[model samples]
Target: MAIVARGQADRGPPRDRCGDPDLDDARDCRRDRRAVVLPRGVARRRQAVDHRRRVAGRRGADAARRAGDGEPAQGAHPDGRAVRRRERHLLHRDGGQPGHAADHRDRRHPRRDPRRAGHGHPGPARALVGRCRHRGPRGASRMTADDLVWILPLIPAVAALAMLAARGRATLVWLDLLASLGVLTLALVIAGEVPSRPIAAGPLRADSLAIPFLLLIGFLAVATSIYSNGWVRHEVAHGGMKASSLRYYHALVQAFIATMLVTVLADNLGILWTAMEGTTITSAVLVGFHGDRRGLEAAWKYIIVTTIGISFGLFGTILIYAAAAHAHGAISDAMSWSEINTIASRLDPGIVRIGFIFVMVGYGTKAGLAPMHMWLPDAHSQAPTPVSALLSGAS
Candidate 1:
């Protein structure tokens, strides 16, 4: 009985061993082994819990710091926000902030990011992104035919400054303007029945179908130019553009005029269509020149609508070519307006009607007819008064 009692005492807890009273001492030995292993497992689990608590506490402190600083709480990783905050905090700790120092040593020799501190760029990456977001439309203003008269000359002048240098610098602008005016005057003189070269032999075609249209365009261009000088001067006075932008404006205006004149004088449908499309591109920038919301919107609408209409005209021109091929086995004859009219009776009426529909619809949009005239009022109202005058008159 004494031996049994001693064994039972050595066994430790009964549940810890197999149900064998004789093997109670074995159970006690096993209990002793477990005591050694259990402490290591418990210590490891405690260490894990302690490590997790430390990490959780650090996250909470970082979150609190961000909240107190009025910064966005980016997650635990060191992202752009975190980096910016650290930089700002360092700057503050060094002395107030980076830009606050008047004659501070660091301020005198400021550290700058290469991207932000470029020759022209003077802001942070985020600031640059913001500026890009705020940037307005590409095409803001409507450039008229008269506007081109000034614009085309300036382009060569600017180019000459780089290319021709001494000689070009002396006379590029004046020469270009004079030459453009001379060409325009020659065209008009020829149209007015003044004696000139064989090229002028095409009768002022006075009573011709296109004569009235050509004369109208010419008169409008002249009137618009007179108005533009005053309007542009007013814009400069009102701070609408810098000197550089004004120079660009003047040059583009003349180029635009040249394109319109070409469109009017084009004896071939292909040439007419090409000139009209050129006019659209040149005028688009003028529409958005003001860099305002309304100006940008108007410019966008005008470009899209006119481009779509012109595409239809292009398709019709191709169809006309196809018709001419079918009728006379000649594509070049189809391009000539005079030939097309003369052969109109012999051509497929269906094809002619379709082509005419396209021409009218396409050119009519430019002509400011209803339905497609949605862009017209906005373009006219937002554009400078001179541009509006040309659009109303010449277009």
Candidate 2:
């Protein structure tokens, strides 16, 4: 009975080495309840912590990369406490983490992404940017010595026109005088003793007659340019010419000078005749510049009479060519004045005399000599004073 009691006592309490049976059972129940409840909550919390840690790690890696590359790290979340805690733990384990203040200073503020900032179409701005890049910097205006050289011829022309246009402006008259002086200087330099090359296949000569004519023309042009300024001004003041008519007048004067220069310099009779005809056309326009009935009628008569006379001159040219063909057997020799003059005595003097008659009549009409003087008085009288001066003096 005693052995049986001892065995029963040893197996008596199914407690965990404690003397209280109820307490032991309560403890085991509590443990079992805890085991059932705590595991799921702890597992969920751990998963959240792990996710936060992973995100924090990614952010830290990105920040590190950005810092190394000298670019701003943006878009990191501030409200993620778990991630912050994990980051703190990691930083503390390594060293101290950079402070929020320092990180804020180091990091740039979030900017509007360039891709999302604007509402306009993107293409034009891009094209503008490309053009800006291509053009680089603006450059200064460039002028050279050769450009200055061109101004020599241009100044006289400009001054002559300006003088005519300014009309009553006394200041411009002085300016015109200065421009003429410049032209004289240029002409002196160009008209050196160096002989001009022959234009046609004949001996080249610069006769006293041609040189004197050239010098006279130049001197007369200078005087006329100065005289025109005052004359046009008087005409304008007196209501004889309008501003627009003055412009045509000045332009025609320059054209006349250029044409006459060509005529005097021409070695070939054909070229001389062409230049003279051009002068006639240009001068006729000047004669009619006023557009009045008298001016128009004068221009008409001048043109008709000159054309008829020049037609005879053309016939004479053709006859000369015919005679040259009979003598020299070359058509080109007929066109050269020097060659014709050299062979004039050998050729039929009667035909030569007739040709001279036609030539003299044609050019003389333009030269304002004799019967052609009928149209001249009307044209000159009707034209502005400056134009009249030019017609009478310069021509």
Candidate 3:
């Protein structure tokens, strides 16, 4: 490096000519800065705008006058204020995108030329160039209907996990309330989104049939969570409900809600049956949580009957799977209800009819349908108030 005498200590950093009042004209500054320092794409757009002005000049004063009227109307918008008084308008409200933008794009792909009729995109507020670029806040993304399908069940499942770290009974109750409300919020969101467009996220999906049950689960969960706050405090005060067991009860309730959500959202027949079985296990534990002889007896009967019915359902599922596989070949998509329904006529009729009977018995038992309806009353009556409400609303 060459040594040189330093400038005066008070001298500030060098300013470009754009900052100088005497030398800077807004139009000239933009043109120079745009050509030399602007990115390649923006420079191309500027060149396109200049070409438009040159063509307008050739069209006589009337064309130029008409073009100027369409530009924005604020001093901050350089193209607006400077056009009539200082210089010709060189930009549009749409961040300087010319009327021939589609034409320009078509020139690059000779075979395709399509013009879009749309509302003019507003320009940036502070920056005098470029299109409006609105992005979601940092570290967040748009949550779609498809995302909510899986997220709904996960909210309560996560709360169940969170319960393990909780200390006080009040904290557990509040956690339950938040989780239930969260599930309700997701259900409402899914309800809004699914009606307009069906959402399918791999193993989980939402359709017309599932929405009502999901909403009921959500509503009942929220209502039960709120009601349990007072009811649980009373049980601890008057009844023999151990203060220590409240956390587990709340956790099991969330897990119960999770199973219900999983059952509703499952797209596969196998997953549905599995989720139903999961519901039985969670609810059985909750049914016996009271630690009384009657409660224990109710829980045992509930599990035995539901387990037997579900086993029939499982056999039915396997038979249906076999039918689907024989029709479509042994493939992974055989387990999906939608796929099975698409080829329903091709399945072995005798095996399908038998499987249907087994499945009706299996799921019907849990649903409290006749002949398998023996366990419903005792289990519901023995379970805690919140669980009873859940069983009633979900069933």
Candidate 4:
């Protein structure tokens, strides 16, 4: 009589289970079998899935605690400690075999079972998993259009500091050109994103209203910086301007650009007014960089006239703030454009009218409108042509 194995053929000499001698299943015939070895790629994928599952489990527990009122609310999954305890209980029941533990739970609860948590992820956790998957195999960092919006202003601000440090070096011109181009590219990127979607980060925000100004400023910055490079070299070659003066001129131009960017990006009217004044001060120095009598006269006039105008603008900003504070009882809430525009109808009508008129006149003076346009012509004509272009187009 011949003895036959459990899964062996009933009537055969000696056939391998899968007709392959290398396979573990072919080596022995067993009634029940499980795979113990996985391919390298399959093992890696399994590890990643396990990592995601662990992260999802922890996040689910955190969400439960945050959403819970007192006890673990009705249908929510158990927290980490409870899940661990349950896992330990199952481990003990199956004599430390995890596969047997899963089978035991399925047999015990055929309808609904907590042990089935391994089946799939929770809702919020699935969303997080989707984001992780989007990061791709290489695990590169991701950026959104909203991130570029806030980064736009920082480009010129950093450039200003770099230009100031590199004062006497001839590379200042190249630095200025590269910095201005970077700002322009970033601004264009932001402008494209802003029309369909407004991007905001804390106090700085960009929308349809700000798009025109940002594009205007960004273009002017690039154009003016390019023009300044050639103009500076020419002036230095001739006796018109000193080579040492180039440092002061380049530094001030960057500072002026940064201030204008801040002005356009400011979310609050008060901050806008302040940044406008900052542009005035920085550009005034650039206007008088030649240090001639006419340049000096122009810078002085620019300072006096704009200072007086901005004072009125400040007063107007204060009046509006006071009115908004009366309505909301919070200064921060009052200062934001979104908050103020929402409650504009409820604010005092008379105060709003007066404040707006003052703001208009004050900003109009800086804008180089009639009657208040006295300082513009002298500053533009006497300053370098590049500075003139900015004063006319951007400032």
TM-score to native of every candidate shown: 0.52, 0.51, 0.66, 0.65
Pairs clashing in candidate 2? none
RMSD of 1: 23.2
Model 3 ranges off by over 4 Å: 1-141
**Ranking, TM-score, top scorer first:** 3, 4, 1, 2
- Model 4, stretches more than 4 Å misplaced? 1-142, 167-170
TM-score for candidate 3, residues paired by index: 0.66
* Deviation in Å, model 2, residue 171 alpha carbon: 11
**Residue pairs in steric clash, candidate 4?**
none
By the lDDT metric, which is better: model 2 or model 3?
3
Candidate with top TM-score is: 3
Off by over 4 Å in 1: 1-184, 194-207
Clashes of each: 23, 0, 0, 0
Ten contiguous residues minimizing lDDT sum, candidate 1: 197-206
Candidate 1 residue 54 C-alpha distance from true site, Å: 99
Q: Give the TM-score of candidate 2.
A: 0.51
- What C-alpha RMSD separates each model from the true structure? 23.2, 20.1, 17.9, 18.0
Candidate ranking (lDDT, best to worst)? 3, 4, 2, 1
The local distance difference test score of each candidate is: 0.59, 0.60, 0.80, 0.75
Query: Alpha carbon lDDT of residue 294, candidate 3?
Result: 94
Q: Which structure among the candidates has the greatest lDDT?
A: 3
Model 4 C-alpha lDDT versus the unseen true structure:
0.75
On residues 22-118, what C-alpha lDDT tens digit does candidate 1 reach at each position? 4546655665545232355566776789999999998888667666755644532222123333334444454454432222222222343334442
Q: In candidate 2, what residue range of length 10 has the lowest lDDT sum?
A: 1-10
